[model samples]
Target: MTTTLAKDPAQAAARHAAPGQKRVTRRPNWVAGTASWIWLAIVIVPIYWIVITSFKAQSDYYAENPLAPPSNPTLANYQLVIESDFVRYFMNSVIVTVGAVVPAVAVSFMAAYAIVRSGRGRFLRYTNSMFLMGLAIPHQATIIPIYLIIIKLGLYDTPMALILPSIAFSIPLSVLVLSNFIRDVPKELFESMRLDGASELGTLWNLALPLTRPAVVTVTIYNALTIWNGFLLPLILTQSPEQRTLPLALWTFQGQYSVNVPAVLASVVLTTLPILVIYVVGRRQLLAGLTAGFGK
Candidate 1:
């Protein structure tokens, strides 16, 4: 005969517990729940006001309370905005965003890859330092110099003026993000690719690019948003109405004596929609990319 050890009392209790039963957690704090609701209302109220105000007529907007729902919602503001140079400004924005973001992300990815994989070459180290230094330089500080350069280069008063500066400013942040993500990629994968007779570019194309796609998408979206809403660069670099981006187009709603507040809001809503859509679509990838190296 053999002796058996006694089961732990807790174990016995757990074993006797009914199948499929789950332990109940304490209820969330009422204070936290109330705070969350309050915060949500704070955020949503303004957005609701904007969307509702965008639909109100000029007469109704002045007649009714600022926060009240529109008694007679009208598309006249949107229609007026569309009939103006809104489409041209919209296209200019799209062109600038695409032109700037694509090249910025591509160049940043390659530069970051070099900085990460080249291990500590003097040039790479210096380049990385330069990018870090760029982060410290504010756009305001460079505007005068950039304006002069644009004039010298004959890029002034053109979409290229906006695109080039946007791309340049965007690169520093993009490289910072991408290089961090690239650094997190396992060295073993690179080594394996090397052993299989892959060139550096081959490994980057076959392995690194695919793995770093989330980061790429994140950077792209980030840069796109920045360039899309960018006001100063467009304001200073370009003068022609045809070259104006959406932010500049809002100027049309202002007059010497009166401002078209509802029309301006409508234009704002339209300008914001594309960027909002981009963020909503890429939010998951953005969160994942940003958090890629946190575990270690």
Candidate 2:
């Protein structure tokens, strides 16, 4: 390669540019750069307001400029939120999110693997079509039937009520995404594993699991975020205060006539913190998995 390049004077000169000279040039994407800044502002402005407002006193929140930094930042609102069964609400949210996400992701992954690995038959084909159809069904449309079903099952007003429905709702999309990832896996790999006397379950664990980790993490994070922030299910299915998830528990700051603005914002911050942390931690894999799915 070196001798070939050296034989061509032009190529050799291009290969070793003059000192303090540029070989390649790039034009700044002014349009994309400007749009990115605008989008960033749109996202960050509300978050900045929420964080700052959460520290303000209720009276000052009304009297002072809402956008300005608080004259006197206080932990009183946070303290008030904590005193108002915030811990219980936080725990309830955690339980519901974990309970719903783990089972949903696990089931979806296995279903996806089967859909790809299992031979195509009328039954499997019908099942895949059914899952695809589910993507179009909105939660609102099914809430009434779900409510009735929950009542009949005697699971109403309990965490289980929320868990069961969330799992069901989460599966279709999860299966769709996971199946795409699993389908992208080489068939030769599966055959080699089978040749080595690995059972289907063992091949799924040792081969599929490791190769498709990014997709698994992607679905897990997505489902967890959805379940964590879910309001309608908890609102309709569980009537009791103890069963209330974070979104529902924010009602604590609301009065019949007036609302505690600062306390509400504080609770919002507390509720959002966990999911935010999880996203930050798993963001890389999530992006990779999503890219892989899209590329496929």
Highest TM-score model number: 1
25-120, model 2: which lDDT tens digit per residue?
Answer: 689999999999999999999999999999999999999998999999999989988888889988998888899999999999898888898776
Task: State the displacement of the C-alpha of residue 59, model 2, in Å, after optimal TM-score superposition.
Answer: 2.6
Per-residue lDDT of 45-142 in model 1, one digit per residue for the tens?
A: 99888899989988888889989989988999899888887889999999999999999999999999999999969999999999999999999999
Candidate models: Cα lDDT each = 0.89, 0.89
Clashing pairs in 1: none
TM-score per model over all chains: 0.89, 0.88
Off by over 4 Å in 2: 1-25, 255-258, 293-296
After superposition, which runs of candidate 1 have C-alpha atoms over 4 Å from their true positions?
A: 1-27, 255-258
